[model samples]
Target: MQTAQRKSLTMLRWMMVASLALPVALFLIAGYVSYGTTYEEADREIRRSLDVVHEHALKVFETIDRSLSEIDEIVRDLTDADIKAREQVLHARLRQLSDALPQLKSAWVFDAHGRPLVNSMLYPAPDMSFLDRDYFDAHVKESVGTFIGATLTPRSPYQGAAFFSISRRRQSDDGSFTGIIQTSVLPDYFEHFYARIGRAPGSYFALRRFDGLVLARFPVTERSAGPAPHDIPAMAADTDRLVTETSPLDAIERRVGYQRLAGYPVYVSAGLDTATIRNRWLGTMSRHLIFGIPATVLLIIFLTLARRRTEHFYVEAARRLEAEDALKHGQRMEALGQLTGGVAHDFNNLLTVIRASADLLRRPNLPDERRQRYIDAISDTVARASKLTSQLLAFARRQTLKPEVFDIGRSVVALRDMTKTLVGSRIEVVTSVPPEPCYVNADAGQFETALINMAVNARDAMAGQGLLSIAVAPASDLPTPVAPHHRPPLGYVAIAVQDTGIGIPQDQFSRIFEPFFTTKTIGHGTGLGLSQVFGFAKQSGGEIGVTSEVGRGATFTLYLPRVAPSHEPRSEAAGHAAPIGGRGMSVLVVEDNIDVGRSATEALAELGYLTTLVDNARDALEELVGGASRFDVVFTDVVMPGMTGLELAEEIRRLDLNIPVVLASGYSHVLAQQGTNGFELLRKPYSIEELSRVLHKVAPVPHHRAPPVAPNSEVR
Candidate 1:
């Protein structure tokens, strides 16, 4: 009776198992099948949408081409006219064309001398001197067709709107050259067209020169003042073909579609809102879950009773695997941090060398133009160093900021040129700056560095085969400069660096800005990028926020305070010569770094000052104390091994009370003391001019006279 009962129970269990398994197995298979079909259909829809988008883009290009062609024909007619009668005909034609083409702000004709033949204004006889603009010079060499200038809003003659010039060469019927025809297009016309092309929010449409200068944009902001993308590699590879790519801009996924103008090499790009499309899919997916989850749960419950042992084993195994993965991740992160730190240190040293060497190259002996070139080189090198330092600081949390009011649009335009060095030849950078000035008060240098680093991080994430987009604009509805609780209005310049690379893992987003945290392989990332951005934003009295996803991309924003209403950014003189002494005097120079010390001494000596060199601050004090016939000035390094230069300066004051002292340091804080006769400070790696000024201020030696310096033009 017991054996019979056990057999009956076993049979019942088997039947229960089959009953549960059949429904779940069937449902799972059916669910997978449905998913496969849905995925295929969705993909097809996306492709179809993309095709439609492409076709619309082609039409837009064709329209622009047609408009340009019409302008070209007009230019030819104006050029063929006789020079003597050019002014009258040009005036009549310009007026007619301006009336005919409402898109035009004005039209004019310019002779070889850049003299305006006819102006489109009511009072057409304005001074021709102003007519000799860049457009005229650009058209002077045009063999055929027209050249379009970057958009500009003429504040005078026309007001309250932006405009860009298109210049076409004029040739006579006999092939002789006459004047050139020019037309200025109002921005609103193109802006309307741009708005229509991809009306989806977060989409980007822009016109850029082959060199990456932004010509026009649909949505604009203050950050647009910075650099945009136009690297040689991407553009070089592009011919007259339409290319589609992907990137992240503003923390949103985007698809870029571009075509070079058929005749002109100008590049026009449109960015599709990937998130919008993905969101549409997500909504669909969410709907499936609403229905599918209950079905799945019911099936699981039915199966669970019969296959409880199998379920237990599967769950336990998954938990163990997750633990193992966590352990491996921790080990990997620790290794990456160490590697990133070491690399940053070495890179910093190299940057220091490059910066210092560039400074050295900018000597007074060079020609004014060459000196300017070297100065530019030095500027470029400093910018590069600043970028590297930002990366290190972002990684290490040590960046300092010096804020100023600036146009973000200008800055981004400039940065586009620099992206090449950071990302190399593989990545292309694109930018869109609004016509409205993006005014913000922040550390311009640091802000720029933040943008560049973000770009580099994006590039690295992309593995050098993607597009990096930067967009600058005023933050909408951001607080004004003085809202105590709200961050002061930075005019809210938003710098967004986006990339179409492998994106951040959802679980790792918060850690991205943490010191030494990374999602990269063991040696790939030190994970300081977002952190430095965070630190930089906080230091500049700004904020940083990010949005990212796995397998998509990321966008980082840095918001800084806008310049105060009453405050305007001061225009700095390109270079200042340190004022030399009115009377010659002997200066005692003390520094431990031989190279720095020697350079200082030599530069001082070159300025006609007698210099005494010592190895440290103590020797400097002794030299001053050892004589009643003391040196006129003491220039000493602030930091040394034993006694700091500050302590030594104090000792010298106790002995030779009247001797003037100027403290120098690589770090600025050590030279903080002021108000005493011995209280002047100078920064190291200073130029000869800087040293001369320090001496003149501290020790006014009676016989000292400044060396005759030529004007800036004569510096070389």
Candidate 2:
């Protein structure tokens, strides 16, 4: 009963652990996946934005290129004096071009000596030296078709602020460079355009020259032109690629995409800040946690409450059942006590009459009539005593069975508790009756007496301490006979008694049920217990059979003709405390030597423990974590292959602290060097008695009916 309860609690523990752990594990994995997804999203967004910026910058640069071509065509074959003759017309043309484009600040026509001839800002051009400007210098050296220059800060009133320049060479008819037509492009134009695209957190846009100089950036920097961010080599080579780098302009890390402006020497960059991406991901996870955590908690709470409620119901049922068993056992023991007392009193009276009559008859020279009467009195007393003895036997359920329709299950269950009182407290008696009633037409008293007889025999075989299991079940027929015997065929209810004790020898099987035959020493046993059981089985039109091994335990089954249920067979329902004497404690035995291992396993079996034997520690652990049986203790050898017994003990504790370890060894350095470490230890060449004693101390007992001080003679 306790074993079942423990198993139930273990199942609940596993459920509780799964409820919390599955969610935690899921969230952890999801966190990693979501973070990566967010990064991918940022990369994609930046890439798309850079495409738009690429088209925008390409269109702006193309406009400047086209305007420069138009100016260059007008001034190409003209000398300085001829171009000065048409200055008004030229100025009006430059002004009209400048008016049409917001990005273009001013357009100018310069002479070969760098004297500005025509200008859009003024009718007469300023006296600026062409030798000083990068656009002018390149055009003069050779007939450069068009050139884009870095930003130039204004040094005169003609230039108001920093501006980039685009210029084309004004060549002669022979294609020699003479002068230049220049356009001043405002950097604020691109900056204002980027501002309209909107700022999202740390997002930014940049336009940089192919020479690694910034033309303009939004979230505008301290200066218009400076070295661009690190990773300029990758930026220059992979024009349409994405990269991650920190912006020197503001020291913000971003996932940036770069696209080179078509037909221009500059690249347009758009980036999504990493800080922004991380913030977005955190929000998503927070929402998930908000929903997930509560659901997990509620699940755990539900399981906990359900387990508690189930335990409460079990406790209440157990208490009621215990109360019923105690009352029933008390009543049976009292009735038997009264019967034994009355029988003994009647036998004493009969003996007194016989002794008195015999003594009178022995008197010498008595009268013949008197002598005859004395002899008759002795004879009558003797006959009466014989009759009284028969009555006693009948009361003890040894004479004749008065068959009646009664529930075999109920009879066994009732007698089972009293049987515990008859067997000593040292032996553990466990009962397993089918929940559905099993009925038969047999003497209820005789059946109970038969059950008690088997239990007493089991107790003696165990030397007072072992497991005695009484199980009742429906059977088709008796088990195959040890030696073939006529057994009533099929359709029987079987009552079985299994004992973990020194088993009977196979050679002695046939003689076990014969009258006056016994395995026990003289005076300790009367030898009629099994014979009586045999008689009862035969008289009731049933059969009794047994199976045994020399060192292991034995099983005896009594099969009776089954009585089909007419109605619900009577039900009676037990402070059957769990025994610490090791009854039903399962043990995992780890020993490498096969012979020694078998001997140890058999010994534990005799000591009333269910055991599993393994030659190595690996197998032992496999049994511990994976096996269906729940072990109460681990009994292992100290020196074995793979993991030592000490190591196995540690591992067992790590897996389940409730199960304890007991180390066994003849002698090993492993044991000598590192003591038992608080574990129980048994040395080699141990006796069966010592093994039983130690296991009784160490095992976690299951709850079952304890044995009584003595088995009543009526049962035997």
lDDT of each: 0.62, 0.74
Q: Model 1: C-alpha RMSD to truth?
A: 23.8
Clashes of each: 41, 4
* Displacement of the residue 668 alpha carbon in candidate 1, Å: 6.0
- Compute the lDDT for candidate 1: 0.62
Candidate 1's clash total is 41
Task: Estimate, for each residue in 555-591, the C-alpha lDDT of model 1 and write its tens digit.
Answer: 8777766654435545452255445743457777777
| TM-score: model 2 vs. ground truth | 0.41
Candidate 2's C-alpha runs over 4 A off are 224-240, 302-716
Model 2: per-residue Cα lDDT at residue 138: 75
Summing lDDT over every window of 10 consecutive residues in candidate 1, give the lowest-scoring window: 707-716
Query: Which run of 10 residues does model 2 get worst, by summed lDDT?
Result: 707-716
lDDT value, residue 544 of candidate 1: 81
TM-score for all models, in order of appearance: 0.38, 0.41
